[model samples]
Target chain A: MRITSQTTSDGVSEHLFTLDDIPGVIWSPSEGTAGRPLVLLGHGGGQHKKAEGLVARAHRYVKDCGFAVAAIDAPGHGDRPKVERHERLVADIRQRVTQGEALGSHIARYNVALAEQAVPEWQATLDALRELDHVGGPVGYWGASMGGAIGVPLVAAEPRITAAVLGLTGHESLTEAARRITVPVEFLLQWDDEMVPRDAGLALFDAFASREKTLHANPGRHAGVPAFELDSSARFFARHLLEDGGPAEVEESSARLDRS
Target chain B: MRITSQTTSDGVSEHLFTLDDIPGVIWSPSEGTAGRPLVLLGHGGGQHKKAEGLVARAHRYVKDCGFAVAAIDAPGHGDRPKVERHERLVADIRQRVTQGEALGSHIARYNVALAEQAVPEWQATLDALRELDHVGGPVGYWGASMGGAIGVPLVAAEPRITAAVLGLTGHESLTEAARRITVPVEFLLQWDDEMVPRDAGLALFDAFASREKTLHANPGRHAGVPAFELDSSARFFARHLLEDGGPAEVEESSARLDRS
Candidate 1:
């Protein structure tokens, strides 16, 4: 692992690094480098580690929860060399989108291939991230769409992840992996998502064996998830990752309506 | 309107009152009786305004948000006299539960009848409550199951309600009312609810015309909504009601991932 660059802004310190050939970045509170929660972010397809949305979310988690956040480029995403096969797949998907054809099977097959390679990369990244002084507490994973496609498999394989907020891409290929995950999960589904069928999303949510999983469905296309969900996800991570003096204490009420 | 009794406990003042023939209760912060948000809770069937769950929720809203919370007995519930027709309906529903027969249509029919009588009483109660100093700000409604049955119509008919958190019971009968509601809504759906069909619940969420409606579905029976949802709803109300110096400002962000 090597740190290539570093900068500080708005009380958050950003560090860019590479483990072997995998390019990644980590965000933390500049002043406090002690033990704090760490959140790993997986960017969507065609997006890199510091995608606008992921950076914003990382900043919020750092500012609101005082947690360290990190993101890494996928196998052929961001600064990595593009694979010819993935390039062909992307072109085919764009063609299919123009033709208005069903994308479920095609995307599922492609994501399965991506997950096989990316999961191990993420595992290695976690191994290196834990060596840092600021990142030693519980861990969380936040990713959607292709990120979710990778996350479903990673969270299932990695015991270090205690909670996750994953969604957008749900396929039969990932069902088995989702079933193996027992951590608290908050899944997102766009009601009118054009790429992924609605039933497929609901079915994936059902496949999670976690006793505590919540599904948040909103009305919009694939990239149109409302901004409020960011806040909701922050609270979810705070509940699971932070052990003391956090927002988790306020939710321990026994107030439930009588089911008549 | 008359206040028949009053008590203070845990920093919340609970007042039992009657508006004409309708029995009701209101909860508020004991010290500050000035302008604040008000939330109206509708209890489930066979339960009353002061149901244990409703009181707990009222106390949280008052203590946490410094807001007034109110709940009124439906026509045939709480301290009100029972209607013979409603009595027959209750017996029939209990019988169906024993026989394990389908209860969707039966409950919808009964709820439609109840809404007709309850909506006007709720409107009158709102009209009376607004006269109180602490209850003049934006209003929100929280109800599910039978409460949702009544809330769908009440929120649709009353223009004063700016936001709502409703779910648990969904049928074709409430479709039109849901379509008419244009305010922000947070809907709940139980994934394994025995009473309400999952499709019907999804359809109800689809029928909402609000530009900012969200659906939060979880794994459980009809009454198994997770406790975290109560805290989530409190934040939803605070966002829509309190215009300044609240938790709403934290959600404003422009972070989003680019979809490939």
Candidate 2:
């Protein structure tokens, strides 16, 4: 692991790391710990490790919940090398739009390929993080859209992940991945997502084998996912991974959302 | 500069080259040239230097036109580390789609940013290639979409280039770049390009200061461009770069296209 750049903010530190070709950012809480839980965050497709949502959530996990957070770019995303097929896909989609054709199969193929390619990479990243001294602790996950697509299969296979917050994505096939995930989960859903059907999101949520799972459905399009939901998710990981937070913290967050 | 990989087919040799993180592939004819003219080809957005379109053109220039061909991935593309903003832009587009909004601004931004950042990198690759003994000769440029966006500014400023094939992209604001380009040009335009307005493309062509310029309008959307177009582009480069193919050859190709 190499630290290419580091930024310190209000006692929290953001360290940019590169191992082989994998580029990632690690955010450590102000109150550091040797065995504190870590949040394995992820960015949506076409996003890098430091996307606004991922960074905001990482900060919330670190500052509000005292959990260390980290994320890496998915394949053909972020600082990683651009894949040629992705470029081909971009051109095809652009051409299709010009022809006024619906992007049904190409979009589906793009989503499936990106998510499938990223799962093993996420696992490799988990292994790399675990070897670091500060990361020797429990882990959770937070991802949306393409990130959610990847997280489902990842959380299913990665036993080290104790919990996950996934949303803004759904394909019936993804339910199979969700069914294998036994970790505590908090799934977000936009009532009128233009890209992902509501039923697909619900189906994945329903498929989760975890005894502790909750679906937070809000009114809005895909981009309309409420901001407060991130706060609740931060609390969710805090309850599962942190020493201080538990059922009381989780219940309080639900109440706050109810009031909002 | 290093040759990381090499493959031979029939009498042609495809060699992958890398220099300080810039990854490219060079295609050579059966009978190599010590100081052969080299075509600096570029790939479209989301593509690496070895994009199929680019590879096909490179091979055509090498095997068919008898000129050495080379291409380097643009910045934030191929083997180079991606820019952080590109990742953010991608996420923003995905989120926007979920909201069922037009991607006018985001797509425009993505195209602009990728092109602007690529110009300097293209210049550097040219400089690096010039130092190699096998690459000592006149150079030409071939690019489309994001490739053309970068090529306009590059050809406008880089006097080393004698000719260029630029098209499939246009923004009125880019005319300023076109205005400075005085090299011989073969500009291709897809009549019904979905991404670039037809007027923008024509306007950019009109802005070009080149005394020797021709517009090749084809029937099709962006991807509907005919394969014969690439052949013409190769012949254009050969007419300008290869000593054997000169004014007579250029006139012959103009006649060939006229009849077709």
Candidate number with greatest lDDT: 1
Q: Cα deviation of B117 in candidate 1 (Å)?
A: 0.6
In model 2 chain A, which range of ten residues has the least summed lDDT?
A: A251-260
DockQ of 1: 0.32
- Poorest 10 consecutive residues by lDDT, candidate 2 chain B: B251-260
**Fraction of the reference Cα-Cα interface contacts (below 8 Å) that each candidate reproduces:** 0.46, 0.00
The residue ranges of model 1 lying beyond 4 angstroms of the native Cα positions read: A245-260, B245-260
- Model 1 misses residue A183 by how many Å? 0.8
- Model 2: how far residue A255 lies from native, Å: 17
lDDT of 2 by residue, B89-120 (tens): 87888898889876545666776787776777
Considering the two chains of model 1, state its CAPRI-style docking category.
acceptable
